[model samples]
Target: MAERRVFITGTAGFIGFHLARLLLAEGFRVHGYDGMTDYYDVRLKQRRHAMLAQSESFTATEARLEDMDTLQRTVEAFRPDIIVHLAAQAGVRYSLEQPRTYIEANIVGTFNVMECARAVPVQHLLMASTSSVYGANEEMPFRETDKADTPLTIYAASKKATEAMGHSYAHIYGLPTTLFRFFTVYGPWGRPDMALFKFTRGILEGTPIDIYNHGDMWRDFTYVDDLVRGIRLLIDAVPPLPEARGGSVPGANVPGDSLSPAAPFRIVNIGNSDRVRLLDFVDAIEAEIGRKAIRNYLPMQAGDVPATWADASLIHALTGFRPATPFREGVARFVAWYRDYYGR
Candidate 1:
């Protein structure tokens, strides 16, 4: 039997790298698409791609999502059965400083991806969304049914725009699409800009880590492995417009509107379902590193949310799996990997 082929963007990113690696291990031919931008640390991204390059089944294309010609050619050449879009301008704080970066990367880039998918139809198209879309939403456990309009950052706004763009594409092109909104994802080979990696790096270097929001923020930190597992399971759970809608209007994959009475589109959450306080997450890292962090508490930055909790019941209902990695174990594994990776 021939192996399945997957075309994934952001293959050099933390989540993309992990997902591509897992697919390769399962005997899937993986084609990774990345711009390899200097958003954070290009060296770190290159290191991740280097690891994936070791896999015989992995092939990477260096192209920005804004480059539609390259993106279209890469997608056509790969002829992927599944297209997972994960690349984006990520960073809430950075978005405040460079909002245009978010527009080009998240909005325009996503538009190109959808256009490519339209050109070459795939079995399933899964794009990454963020819990930040919840914005100022105070819903304890955010659901797929929640209205995610009040995005706090340009980053979130761009992502929310992509969700809308994807829905329109799905409706017009009859595409089978799934949008997975992820909570605060962290683990081995994580992004340095994220809280976990920053806190770990600072604590180990004896530098005071910036504790934002006066260490009062809450995050549903989902481990990368668990997140990829959720994505893996969701591969088969394509969105189908409910039969009861009379099949009048074509289905759309909009986050708040699963209006396809006929089209295949859905939104799902991939998270741990447990919100951890910022201080508690720091403590977990401290326990693993055997060091205490000198915290510099500060006010919440603009475009930042106070807390995030995911209601992953829909994902559990669909995949019969939830991110089960305990916070302590997950933090320990990340710290251990961090120590070894950096030779600390």
Candidate 2:
């Protein structure tokens, strides 16, 4: 296939930065959009954008997703073959403090993205969802088809709302859409608020690191590179409309595939599919830092799930790829990057 022009939002963010880098490396002309929010540290986001700017194929726009005019203009000007919408007000706990931001960013912002895609009619419109959507779901390994109606936080609810909105647009406008539910994503350039990053920082600084749920939580910790690889593969596996699939959604017979029957859309899980204990993850970081962390065990915060494990079979079936990075190895890589980046 020839190199395609792609538009990716949140290119300055963690996952977005990694995905854009991977796409650029594969010779794709990428137009990146990010708000450069000061949610954690603007320097980290800026650093990511600067690195991407070094690539000739990367063109970035610093703007918020809530700004419909700017987003629409960027998308119209780029005229991208594929659109990856990853920007959002992310964080389960943070959502509790500011629910309105979730509504504005994830809902209104996602609506604008959908509108742009509808106008331009890209070949594939892929957006990021979260495993938190499976709130209150006790299923060991969460599947795409699982009922995710019980969202515990506004953050998850907003993402779920976006999924519904995307489906409606696909059903009405014939837009080929895919929503990938991400598990606990971690690695180099990860968010400072995430457990892995915080743990690494605290361990190196000899500070106390909070261990939520008494270090009993479990997460399907997906490495950034592995997650990006799964995404790259899925870009080519665009969903087909029901008419094109012989009057039914393709992969209905497939056990884990969540191909929608009414439209050319699907929900795939992009995760490691292996749950790692929170304490074990901390242990990995401590080992890498060569010091035991001052652990501060705490009760589970509101809207927090005890564990999350992805049923990744659907993505593997669709793209012949799966995120298989082990927690220890991925943590070590992140620690190495952390030390080098901070001059520790």
Name the candidate that leads on TM-score: 2
Q: Model 2: which residue pairs collide?
A: none
| Superposition error at 254 for model 1 (Å) | 17
Q: Which model scores highest in lDDT?
A: 2
- Residues 1-344, model 2: lDDT tens digits: 87799999999999999999999999999999999988899999999999999999999899998888998989999999999999999999999999999999999999999999999989999999999999999977999999999999999999999999999999999999999999999999999999888988888888999999898899999999999999999998888887777535555445566879899889999999998888888888888788999999999999999999998999888877888988889988999999899999
The C-alpha TM-scores of every prediction are 0.94, 0.97
Off by over 4 Å in 1: 241-262
lDDT of each: 0.88, 0.92
Against the true structure, candidate 1 has what lDDT?
A: 0.88
